[model samples]
Target chain A: MIDIQLSERQEKIIDIVKANQPITSEEIAKRLSFTRATIRPDLAILTMSGILDARPKVGYFYSGREAMSFFTNQINSMKVSDIKSLPIVVDEQTTLYDAIVTLFLEDVGSIYVTSEGFLTGVVSRKDFLKNSIGGVDLNKIPVGVIMTRMPNIVTITPEDSIIDAAVKIMEHQVDSLPVIEETVINNKHGYKVIGKISKTNIVRVFVDLCKNN
Target chain B: MIDIQLSERQEKIIDIVKANQPITSEEIAKRLSFTRATIRPDLAILTMSGILDARPKVGYFYSGREAMSFFTNQINSMKVSDIKSLPIVVDEQTTLYDAIVTLFLEDVGSIYVTSEGFLTGVVSRKDFLKNSIGGVDLNKIPVGVIMTRMPNIVTITPEDSIIDAAVKIMEHQVDSLPVIEETVINNKHGYKVIGKISKTNIVRVFVDLCKNN
Candidate 1:
């Protein structure tokens, strides 16, 4: 199946049509503050993309039941492995100062702490904010001192569904979750960090569902 | 017409069914690390909510089309007036230092800057981050100096569709947008801040659509 990217204006136009089917291009343009001529090409592209349909008198309507079915099928069948993204990892020895820089540099909400390639702990932006409130010397403090330790870290396996991941995110009130794989170590269970699922990933899925459908 | 709040577990159950329709309660329980008995009550609640349907041999399937239609109708017909939330406004004369505290205290990504009750400018977390990088004297700098000025501001009116608000949010790459109403002031156009919309609001709508549908 082809996945096409839509401009914000085009997406807005679709929203308008979904709300008001048989809406004219002139109406869409009026709502968006663009001239009718400027938006004509957008209408043409949307129609060509199978997102909209038009007629001599009926104007434009959504032509997306097929797309919707495609999306529904994917979401229903997709596992966490299909959509989990890479997690930004840091060493336990990394200083809190470095972690802050890494956070901003990576532009992520949290960082995973790894020791010898095993999942250890997790740190988030909120965690840093809390620590910073006391005015501690970040340069001397290692991130490990403040991370949420293992056994306390909420994780998901790749075998889990995307729905499970979404639930964990909302329940934990965290921005993301580490996708882990359960391993037996000395007859005890341990989790190995494999990937991550974030709020942004969920949003992307929703947006793509709208675009592809 | 009714919006029922769903427990997190109930929401996850719906997600599981969406991913695996015609799924038995036993299979769902197995996936969720819960006993069949523990989940039966949740399943009963879901089925009762009209979010799910079941047959003698077919197990459970989603009955969310009606819910989806309800959500679609809301998004289609709801105006900013219907969903707009309160904006966190601060005077333009406030110090950058105070603004930083307000942002973290309020747990908001952006803040509105008003001058004598008139919307003047806007500041965001990113703006503060960029300014703080050089370790400038935040106490001496007024927020008005660092805020985005009007004519450059992206705004929505209370009459705009919720879809229109969503598009403006994604287009501007901002976490939130101010809902404003234009007014005639001293023979010039001025905007009166009425409310706000954020990415969280859009996500809430999506989540509610899933829950209701």
Candidate 2:
């Protein structure tokens, strides 16, 4: 793939085609006060780039394909697994106070809670802060009690695109998502947390996109 | 601007040019076993897209410009002011408990602290959770006592590119950056918080990029 910055005359040629499509090259040349030969190369570049469509006997037609289509294609090709990070997981029996310590040690925004080795819930710093300040006995209560449980928690899978993850993060207004995989533990259907995709991960991808470019 | 997916013949032409520098079009056509007229359009597209350079007599040279340059250009053109959100600011005298309430109310990742209307410090959810569990009297202590103070906070200006902001956020390992401008108040030189760019903002930008495309 290659990118081309269109010249002023080429841009003007596109405008002419958009306004008077199906008009032959001779008419386009006449409008710009140039001969057919002088504008042939411009028409070739436009059609080859998919910005204009040409028929055998007809003139050019504007295709309206923006330069961003290439960017969109690149972004769509990146999967969630490509950028996901390790999830901080804890057992449901772990006390809230202990989970908070794990959050600090890992320096992550959220933690995944598992029961019987299957995903059950998720808790974030906000939840910890709210409960801690509300005079809850952090040592006595289990993390499972305060977490946003399954069916309510937003999630993503490894096959999902990074753009899908970003959309879920924005639409759900959550800091991160638990990347899960379908599983059955003792014949009970559940999801097992495999990875995590957060706002931080998305930001990192954005930076890499520019740096790599 | 336009994007072009190079044809198979164009790809072969690039490979040939990279292997043999200053190779004339006649030589290129001979290697491909095609007449010069047959590959003229392919060569025209390659040179126009800047992937190859054609000299008067020296033939063709590989330019090595990738398709990603357009992506980089779009990102660099976006300024912090274009996507920055409103900053959540609190006075230095505000109590830690009150600040936490403000944080929860605004649902922001970090809060900017101002002393007499100039940025002085910053605090995140981690800081709040750490202090709240450390036996500190949340209602009695001022927010200034625990904030990451001036000269230590990462900041961005309105004119800085979004890429620069993302770079600083990743490098500093911070959740957000306060958009500031130089100011003088009471003979004190300091920054006045104008807006904020956080991971959320970057993620939103990422989503918008794909959506707009």
Residue B129 error, candidate 2, Å: 0.4
- DockQ for every prediction shown: 0.02, 0.50
Native contacts retained by model 1, as a fraction? 0.01
Please identify model 1 stretches exceeding 4 Å from their true place: A1-74, A129-134, A184-189, B1-75, B129-133, B151-154, B185-188
Q: How many residue pairs clash in all the candidates, one count each? A: 2, 0
lDDT of each residue in B137-209, candidate 1, tens digit only: 8889999999999878889999988777776676666667899987877676788899988766666555555
Per-residue alpha-carbon lDDT of candidate 2 for residues A1-213, written as tens digits (9 for 90 to 100): 677788888999989998998789999999999988777778877888778899989878888766455677789899999999999999999999999999999999999999998999999999999999988789999998999998899999999999999999999999999999999989999899999999999999899888877
- Two-chain complex of model 2, DockQ on C-alpha atoms against the true structure: 0.50
Superposed Cα deviation of residue A120, candidate 2 (Å): 1.3
| TM-score, one value per model | 0.59, 0.81
Error of 1 at B178 (Å): 2.5
Candidate 2 off by > 4 Å? A5-68, B5-36, B50-68
